[model samples]
Target chain A: MWAFTLRRLLYAVPVLLGVSMLVFALIHLAPGDVVDILVPPEVPKEIADSLRQRFHLDEQLYVQYVAWLGRLMVGDFGVSFFTGRPVAEELFGALGNTLVLALPAAVLGFLLGIALGALAAYNHGTWLDKLFSATAIIGVSLPHYWVGIVLVAIFAVVLNLLPAQGMGFEGLPTSWEHVQHLVLPVVTLSLIPMGVISRLVRANVLEILSQEFVGTLHAKGLFSRRVLYHTLKNAAPSALALMGLQFGYLLGGSILVETVFNWPGSGGLMNLAIFRRDVPVLSATIVVLAAIFVVINILVDVLQALLDPRMRR
Target chain B: MSQVLANLPRATEPVVSVEDLHVRFLLREATVAAINGVSFDLEAGQVLGILGESGSGKSVTLRSLMRLLPPARTRTEGRIRIAGHEITAMDETALRHVRGAKVAMIFQEPMVALDPVFTIGVQIAETIVRHEGISYSAANQRALELLEMVQIPSAARRLKSYPHEMSGGMRQRAMIALALSCRPTVLLADEPTTALDVTVQIQIILLLRQLQQELGMAVIFVTHDVGVAIEVADRIAVMYAGRFVEVGPTEKVIDTPAHPYTAALLTSTVLGSTFGRRLEAIPGTPPDLRALPAGCSFAPRCRHAQDRCRVHMPPEAVLAPGRITRCVRVADGELDLGSPNLSERSIAKP
Candidate 1:
């Protein structure tokens, strides 16, 4: 098992690097740079030259890429063009906040999705099944940003129950306060994925329930609950695969969610950097998110293969 | 009934007696009556072989005994008595207790009969725990004993192995062991060896026969193979179109098949065929259950099907000692079986 996990982890490195390199190229190839965006229109040519030289903007594209790659190897993502701080420092702080929001939402989505999906599958073709399935379809079809905006509009504008947007203030205790601030954003972000995962789980559970093993389990005279739980447990590898993929997707997709909520997460940071054309911060954030996604997918695949031996070969 | 029970053999009465059993499956806009008025008595420790083609209702009848038929869609109408207790009317919980503890089923496909995620040991252990209320360790120990009983090598080591790690034969053996772990009085092997390769198929059948003898459990061996039916089963019930066409002692049924369908089945088997002509196949598939003929379900496929056979379903006829056949013409001697002259004219007419 350790060997399997270590092998999977090792395989993730090139996947991360490949994705990083692609994003890096695309970011660099896009027109405009941090220097172009940050410099004043009135600034003289010599001053612009010094600033360009300072940030290595004067170097060739390949040279700059190699220098950035070298710095990345030593655990440095270089300084943010706007913040003038190590990109890693900003990234870590933002990552913590993003996780704070994403983790709960993910947990909530998974819990609700699995339960709902299981219920729907168990009572398949009934009214309850139809209700849950329809709700999931609508949830999945609606866009995250649109859902976030609608949630904000109804709760903050019409009901006036909570703050419209943004994280908690500096003085207020965060746990409950932040959670209150998080509800709308988290719900909006989780809806589509929750719908998707639950539907997938329902399909998988329904399929597994019909398997001959399930019949054998029934014939063994095990309790209905025992049979159901056993079947679901066996069916879990498929569900787990979806959950893993969704986890990776959530890590990256949460950016749009965070932007809508005005949450101070990596997504929001990336959004700001994009607007200011902070290439280093944007590239670093993309690289990190891509790497995290790759790692998560690899972990999920390995875990699935481990849990269900059929995939080993 | 009480006197009969008292006079009967020492095992807990005949484990199950299914009388006039009918099962109908509602699919989409149509209802297919799979089992129609099927009756049988399974004595404890006796291997009862149900032989038929694919849609002959053997599996359905077996499933109905436990009320394991898929939810509200499939309806089971019958008096299924397990230890003189009516199983058809029992609630889900009661039926559940009866299923694994008193009556267990071994399905057709061995590889698919055990859940893939759990280790073979854990799978068997679960049955022990569920039915016996034993501790995990005790259950595991019993599971190992069962594994050994089924001749699974390296029983202890294989406990941790997943379903896919084992070969097809091993998986089937594991399934059998799991079923046996519960110590069920009635073991329903629904075409247990059907999914196995030909060589492994014989091994499984022999193993089942051995286990049945050792355990003294009533085994309902459901199979389409007449050869297998003769080898393992003491009594054989030949079903056609969800009805029991003929049922009697294995030797009697094989030698003097009273029903036309049974005769056709026996003739089709190459086991004792003297002539080495190319093998014959059952002319057509079983009739569509949804659109069945008005009278006998087997009329379409019967060589001796007459006008009366098409108007009325065949009544049970006791042609010989211990032999029961459901055929209209056989009772009246309208159909001759002594030397069925199947010339070109009689063959193509049906």
Candidate 2:
């Protein structure tokens, strides 16, 4: 089992390397950069030359890529072009901020999804099933940013219940005062995942319920609840596989949601870097997000193997 | 040990009895009459083999004994009394105690029948814990003993292995061990050996017979193989469509089948000495269960179907003593098929 985990981790290395290369290349391949904003309509050529030389934009694309990759290996993300702030510091703070919202939202969404899915699947054709199914469909289908705007309009604007946007604190949310700033963003971020996870869980539970062993369990005189336990255990591995991917999506896909709330997360950071043409901050955020995604994939594989003995090989 | 003491006063009463059981599967467009009207009584320590091809309602009959049919669309009617518990009358909660405690079933394919995620020991022990209310450790010990009883090698180690890790035959052994764990009064085996290798098939049959005798438990063994039925059964019930056409002592039924359907079934198998005795082959397929004829279900396939035979279902005609056949032609004694003690007369002529 340890060997399986190790092998999966090893497999992830190449994928992450590929993602790093792409993040670097794709960001650099864009049309404009800090150079465009830095230079005026008719600046002195030597001043522009000094700016280009300082950031090494004057170097060949391969040299720039190799240099960036080399520095990245040693944990240096370079300084931000607009603010002259260290990219790593800015990136980590944004990641921590994202974690505060995404983590709780994920927890809420996942737990609710699993509960609703199991209930709906066991009940199958009743009104409860239809109600939950409709909820899940609406969740997955709706635009989350639009949902966020409506949430802000109702709670912050109309009811005067909660603060509208931004992290109340400078960093991670710890106290309740800072946490209230979380309501709209977390709810907006969670809707799509709740819908996605619940649907996956429902389908898996329904499929497992029909397997032949469920009849065997029934024949064994197991209580209906006991039979349900067996059904859920079998259903878990597949549901968990999707949950892992959804977790990655929750963190990475919360960009627009974060933008609407004005929350300081990687999504917000990337948004700022994109407009200002801050290549260092942009490259660092994308690579870090891509790396997090790869790690999630590995964790899902290992967790699935643990749950299902058949996957040990 | 506990079974023998309980068997004294109830030895005369059949361990399992079903009367006029009917099963119908209600689909969107049609209602499938899976089991029309089947009746049987199996006493303690006896094995009644139900022989039939697919869709003959044999498996459906076995499942009906436990009320295992889906409650949504499938309807099961009539009395099923196993170990003195009225199966059809019991509610879901009451049925649980009677299910693994009084009546248990082994399925056709062990790999499919056994829970794949759980270890064999866990599956077996859970049953003991559920019905017997024993401690988990005690249940585990009993589970180990059961695996050994089923002749599983390295029993202790094998207990921890998942179903997929074991061979087909071993998994079936695990299945049997699990079935017998709660010491049910009767066991319903639905083609238990059908998915095993041919060589393993005999071994499982022998093991079942030996266990049944040792435990003195009644068993309703459902199978498609003629040899398997004859090998394990004292009495044989040959089913056609949804009802039993003939049921008698194994020797009597095989040597001189009173019903034409039974005769066709016997001749179709490539058994020793019974080979090339294909006097008549069954024609066409089983009737679409959704649209069964009003009269005898086998009339279309039977060569001796008279106009009357096509008009009314045959009554269960008792020839002598325990021999019963569902065929109108049997009443006339012109069956050319067989009469009671026909095997003796045919032997004497030779």
Candidate 3:
């Protein structure tokens, strides 16, 4: 098992490299530069040239890529073009904020999805099943930004309950205060994944319920709840795989949601970098996000193997 | 063990009794009458083999004993009594206790019958704990004992093995151990050896017979193979199109089949003089349940069907003690009763 995990990790190395190369090339290919954004349109050509030289924007694309790759190997993300701060420091701060938002959202979404899915399966063909199925479809269709706006309008603007945007008050790190700020953004970010995960879980549970072993379990005099538990255990590998994918999607797809809620996560930071053409921060964030996605996929594989003995090989 | 046996009701009472069982599957466009007016009784330590071809309602009859059919989609009218308890009228909670305790079932495919993710030991132990309310460790120990009881090699190690890791025969053995764990008075085996190899089938038949005798439980073994039915069943009930056409002691049923269907089945086997001759396959497919004829369902396939046979259903007739056959021709004395060729019969007997 350890060997399998190690092998997967090894396989991820080239994948990460490929992702980085693609992101770098795509960003470079866009019709603008950091120097153009930094220097005023009224500035003389020499000042623009000096800024380009300082940031090594004058270097050939391959040279720039190789230099960035070398620095990345040694745990350096260079400096941010706009802030002049170490890109690593800026990236980590943004990542931590994203984690604070994404982790709770993921955990809550997964739990909610499983609960609703189990209920949907247990009450199959009933009004409850129809209700949940409708809710899942609606949740999947409603865009996150729209959900965020609607929630802000209802809770923040009309009801005067719970703040709608940002991480928290600048000086208040109290957990409850943080939670107050987190409600809307997390809800908006988690809706699509929650819908997707619940639908996947419902389908899997329904399939497992019809399996021959479920009949055996029933014949064994197991209560319906226990039978459902066994069904869930058998369905876990598939559910876990979906949850992993949903988590990866939540991390990368939170950009628009973060922009709406004014959440200071990496997604928001990436949004700003894209508009400003901050190449260093943009490339660094994409690489880090891709790396996290690869790591999650590996973790999911290991978990699936552990859950299903048939996959251990 | 003595105390457990003492707690049981008198051994003279039949372990299983079914009366006029009728199962109908309600589909969108049609209602399928799967089982029609089947009745039987089984005493302790006896095996009654139900023989039929596919769609003959062999499985439907067995599953109804446990009320395992989907409630909304299936309608069953019958009285099923297992170990003196009226299962047909019992509520779900009461039925739960009856299952795996007074009546247990083992299915045809062992790999699918056992959950793939769980260790065999956990599944067995779970059944024990659910019924007996024992501690986990105690249940685990019982699981090991059950595996050993089924004669599995390396039983201790197999306790931790998943269903997929074991061979088909081993998985079936494990399933048997699970079925017998609660010492149920009645075991419903639905073609338990059908998915196994021929050699493994014989082994399972022997094991089941040995287990039934040792545990003194009544077994209703369902199968499509006449040969397998002969090997394991003391009494045989030959079903056709959802109803039993002939039922009697194994020897009587095979030697002088009263029903034309049973006689036709005997001649179709690849044993005796028929071994080298072209097989006498049954002439037509089973009648569709939705549009069944008002008279006998098998009249279209029976060789001796007369106008009257097609116009009216045959009443079940008593032919001597402990024997019943449903054929109008059997009562008319026009049916051929020649002894089934002994050479073929002997060769067919396992």
Candidate 4:
């Protein structure tokens, strides 16, 4: 198991490097650098040239890539061109805020998905199956940001039952007021994972049900609940992998939902970086998100290998 | 009924009995008459091999004995009793209690029959725990003993292995171990060795025979292999289109098969002493169960099929004394399938 974990971690190095390279290439490929947006037309050529050289804009693309890569390895994410604030400090705060939202939403969405999927699969071809399946489809298909706006209108504007946006001044939702601030965005962000994971679980459970082993289980005279235990164990590996992927989607932070809720997460930060052309923050955020996705996938792979012995090789 | 139970020979009463058993699969598209009027009684310590091709209802018959058929889609008509439990009348809860406790089964494909994610020991141990209400550790010990009984090498280590880690033969051995864990009186084996190689097939057959005799459990063995049936069964039932066309002592039926279907099956198989002869195949496919003709089910495939064979279904007739065969010609005693030997009848129609 330790070897498996070590091997999965080893496999991530190239992926992280590739994502970093892509982030660097994308910023370079854009129409202008941070200096173009930061410097005014009235600024003298020497002043603009000094600003450009400061940000490594004076070097070749590969040379700049190597420089950025070196700093990235040393946990140096430069600084935002707009505010002159260290990107790592600014990004970590937003990263923590996103984690607070994403983790809860992932728990809510994935647990609901597993329960609903198991219910639908067990009651396959029945009205309950149809009802849950339709619910999941609607959850996925609904314009969730629009749903977020409706929630805010109902809760903040009309009912005045709860706060509609933001995590009550950011770090963690410590009080009830702060927790209420989490509700709308978390609910909104969770819809896609809930829908996707449910469908995947339903299909996977149905497939396991159809295998000849189910009959063997029956012939062994296991109770219905015990039979379900065996079914769930077999269905777990694939479902866990899907959950990791869906959780990856969640952690990426839906920009629209975050905007609608006025949440100070990575999504809103990235939104600011894009409009202002804060190249360092934008590239750093993208690399961090991609690395997180890779790490989540590695964790899922190791977990799946533990669950299913055949997958160890 | 109470007086009848009292009068019957307690030692001779059959461990498993099926009366006028019928099974139909009620699919949305069609109603399939999978088993049509099947009946049999298997006494304690005896082995009855049900031989047939695929879709001939041999498997259905075995599954129905334990009410293992899908309830939502199946319509069964009959009575089944196994080890003093009325299977047909039992509810889900009752059936579950009796399934592995009194009646167990070994499915055809061992690879699929054993749960792939679970260890072999847990699968076997769970059944023992479920039926006997024993401690988990005790059940595990019993599981180890069963594995050893079935001749799994390094029984202790093999118990921790999942189904996929084992070879096909080892998986089947684990399957047999699971079926025997609760010391069931009647074991229904649905082509348990069909997925195994010829070499492994013989080993499994020998092991099953040895266990059956040692445990003194009544067994209903279903198979397509003639040699397997001959080697293991005391009585052989030749099934065609959901009905047993011929059933008799294994030696009697194998030596002188009255039905042409049985005769064809024997001739087609590559058994001992029949190597040099050009073997024959049963002509045509089995009759469709959904829309069977009002005649002998084997008429299309029978070489001796006459005009009358296609006109009406033949009723069961006594072949000698203990044996029974169904054929229009055999009904009239006009077909001399084979000369009879001594007739010391031990079993008669119920």
What DockQ does each prediction reach against the true complex?
0.80, 0.78, 0.84, 0.77
Note the Cα lDDT for every prediction shown. Answer: 0.81, 0.86, 0.87, 0.87
lDDT of 3 by residue, B19-100 (tens): 9999999998999999989998887777899998889999999999999988889999989999988989999999999999
> On residues A1-313, what C-alpha lDDT tens digit does candidate 4 reach at each position?
8898899999999989888988889788988656767878898989999988778789999999998899999999998898899999989998888889899999999999989999999999999999989989999999999989998999889999888766776577778877888888888888888998899899999999999899888888899999999999999999999988988877777789888988878888998999999988999999999999999999999999988988987
Chain A alone, TM-score for each of the models? 0.92, 0.95, 0.94, 0.97
Candidate 3, RMSD to the unseen true structure: 3.7
Tens digits of per-residue lDDT for model 2, A1-313:
9899989988988898898888878877877655868678598878888899999999998899999999999999999988899999999988888888889898989988998888899889889999999999999898989999999999999999999987789866678878799878888888877898889889988988887898899999999988988888888888888888888877764678888888878888888888888889999888888889888888888888877899888
Which residue pairs show collisions in model 2?
none
Judging by DockQ, tell me the better candidate of 1 and 4.
1
TM-score (all chains, Cα) for each model: 0.93, 0.94, 0.94, 0.94
Backbone clash count for every predicted candidate, in the order shown: 2, 0, 0, 0
Please give the distance, in angstroms, between residue B267's alpha carbon in candidate 1 and its true position after superposition: 1.5
- Residue pairs whose backbone atoms clash in candidate 4: none
The TM-score that candidate 2 achieves is 0.94
Q: Is the docking of candidate 1 incorrect, acceptable, medium or high quality?
A: medium
True contacts kept of 3: 0.84
Q: What is the C-alpha RMSD of each candidate to the true structure, in Å?
A: 3.9, 3.3, 3.7, 5.1
Task: Please list the residue runs of candidate 2 whose C-alpha ends up more than 4 Å from where it truly belongs after superposition.
Answer: B1-10, B272-280, B339-350
lDDT of 2 by residue, B1-350 (tens): 22343355646788788899999999989899999898888888778899999999999999989988889889988888899999999999999998888899999989988888899999999999999889999999999999999999999999899999999999999999999999988999999999999999989988998898888888889999989998888789999888988999888888889898887777566662332233334688988899988788888988888898888888899987768999888767877774422345334433
True contacts kept of each: 0.95, 0.75, 0.84, 0.75
Segments of candidate 1 deviating more than 4 angstroms: A170-175, A253-256, B1-13, B334-336, B339-350
* Chain B alone vs. reference chain B, TM-score for every model: 0.91, 0.92, 0.93, 0.92
